[model samples]
Target: MHPHSPPWRKSPLRVWLSSGISSLFELLNAANELFSRPRNLSSPRTPR
Candidate 1:
């Protein structure tokens, strides 16, 4: 085989990377939402 690779061979890796990145972004978004909205109990950011 030659040193170079074909497009079909790279598709699986590219797809996997894309999916992993999307999942990471989703997790970050969930964390951001939770931080943005505190629990029902008292919080330092919210005054009495």
Candidate 2:
């Protein structure tokens, strides 16, 4: 068997953990943008 074989690699748990962390950050950022501002058509910037 070779030293750099599949058996020497880390398990799937590590991959899942890293993916979850990154996804969580993306979700939080999207939520922050969604809640931090209000969309209004009656504002001065609106077109008549």
Candidate 3:
């Protein structure tokens, strides 16, 4: 049941890769949100 072997021995690899990719996307999206919007720490930095 080696990962680099035949497809029949890749079930764990498949699940691992899919979950890793999904979490990677979630992290990226969260970072994008953090930078793309301004948070109201104390005063709103909106335009005057």
In model 3, the clashing pairs are: none
Predicted candidate 1 versus true structure: per-residue lDDT over 1-48, tens digit per residue: 678787867788888988999999999999988876676444765786
Point out the worst 10-residue segment of candidate 2 by lDDT: 36-45
**Cα RMSD, each candidate:** 4.9, 5.3, 5.8
Model 2 TM-score (2 dp)? 0.58
Candidate 2's displacement at residue 15, Å, is: 0.3
Model 3, range 1-48, lDDT digits (tens) per residue? 645777745688888989999999999999988766656532466565
User: Cα lDDT for residue 5, model 1?
Assistant: 81
Measured against the true structure, the TM-scores of the candidates, in listed sequence, are 0.54, 0.58, 0.53
- Winner by lDDT: 1
Instruction: Select the stronger candidate by lDDT from 1 and 2.
Output: 1
In order of listing, the candidates' clash counts read 0, 0, 0
Q: Which runs in model 2 stand beyond 4 Å of their true positions?
A: 1-9, 39-48
Those runs of model 3 whose alpha carbons end farther than 4 Å from true positions after fitting are 1-10, 39-48
